[model samples]
Target: MIPPDNQIYIIIFSTIFLGGLMSTFVVAMVFIHRQRQAQSRQKMDQMQVEFEKTLRHVENEIHQETLTQIGRDLHDNIGQLLSLTKLNLNSSKPEKHLEARECVNEAIKEVRALSKTLNLDWVESLSLDEYIAQQLQRIQATGFCETSLQSDRSFAELKKEEKLVLIRVVQECLNNAIKHAQPDRIAIRISKNGRARHIEIEDNGQGFDTSKQSNGSGMYNLSKRMETIGGKFSLSSAVGKGTLVNLELPFSV
Candidate 1:
């Protein structure tokens, strides 16, 4: 049997030990919480950096494409009109001068139209369906292939960044079809399925094996870009069957 004084001392020691243990536990929990918060912040910062990088890349690509289109129009359309205007002006006939004035007016209009496309604001103003239709029309105008667009026109509005990324991806797909597929017919379909928007670009060209590794990084890069935008990209192809690209994006509520 312990004496009363000894009992008091034991109780006090036990109380002090328990209090110290609780303090250590609380400190450990707080440290763990703060460490997790720091990690979360770091991850979010890294994501923002990557998104900015992608945005810059998309902007550059769009600018380059705009320049190329402008160059083509200048050489093919505007230049020809100017040459005709010069020829008409050189003629002695006053009627030819009137014709020359008409040509100049037409050239002015074309220039104004081309100027609108030069600005990135057009990207924001154009809907995805409209852009796809325009692209198909351009291809058809080239007589490269028979192009078709089928759309339910139920596309949700997207942020400028999201729209830009989507436009580039679609452009890349179309280019790949023209360059590699050599398909006689290219068809694009846009639709909405439940909570997602779906686009399928299909080519009736020579398709490659999906199981085999691609010789280039184009396919891999496309997949990654879609992931960055919270979208999904899938390519299905088989020998002699042709290639189809499926793009899916969730509708933000």
Candidate 2:
């Protein structure tokens, strides 16, 4: 057997070895935890950057659309009014002068209205359903196709970024339907499905096969955009049957 002094030394060495081993393990675990935290932070930063890029794109598209609408209004509505006002002012009759004044006033009001749409503030001011209704009404006014919005309940309020993304997606869907579908009627229905809200845009136009890959990147971009906003995009179409596009958003999101 070993001497008493040697046995005490052995016991001290064993305890020190075990303590050192535990210290190394704890250090390793802490390093792993900190590394994972850094990775998570990096991922969050990337997502935030992507979301900001999407918001910029949405803002640009909305500005372009607003400018186009303003151009149309100026050419078709305000321009005519100003011309009428000039003609009435040139006339000798006092009644004609009064009509000219009225036309000028109406034109001023229209200009004021158009000016309000020049900024991105409208995106935050308007609700989703209200915007949808306005879009459908604008389409119906064009007489290109019959458009309808059917909603029994209001949708959940979304953040400004989510609203912008959703509006852009909806606009793209309507544009595709009008440009390619050649449908007689386009119907947008909004409904609440349990914990989610659904917006369905259906057109009675010539539908293409969904199984075949699309040559355009529009659908893929739409899906990505929806995913960014914690939403889902679904499209169904057949060769002879009509096409339907559905957008779903969870209430918790």
Residues 1-253 of candidate 1: C-alpha lDDT, one tens digit per residue: 9999999999999999999999999999999999999999999999989988988898899899889989998999999999999999999999999999999999999999998998798887899889888989989999999999999876647878888889999999999999999899999999989888988999999998888856788988888788888999998999899999999989877
For residues 1-253, could you state the per-residue lDDT of candidate 2 as single tens digits?
9999999999999999999999999999999999999999999999999988988988899889889989999999899999999999999999999999999999999999999999988888888888898888888888889998899654647888888988999999999998999998999999988888899999999999888957889999999999888999999999878899999988863
RMSD of each: 2.0, 2.7
- In model 1, the Cα lDDT at residue 227 comes to 81
Overall lDDT per candidate, in order of appearance: 0.91, 0.91
Look at candidate 1 and give me any clashing residue pairs.
Answer: none
Q: Say which candidate scores most in TM-score.
A: 1
lDDT score for residue 251 of model 2: 83
lDDT of 1: 0.91
Worst 10 residues of 1 by lDDT: 153-162
Instruction: Judge candidate 2 at residue 134 and give its lDDT.
Output: 89
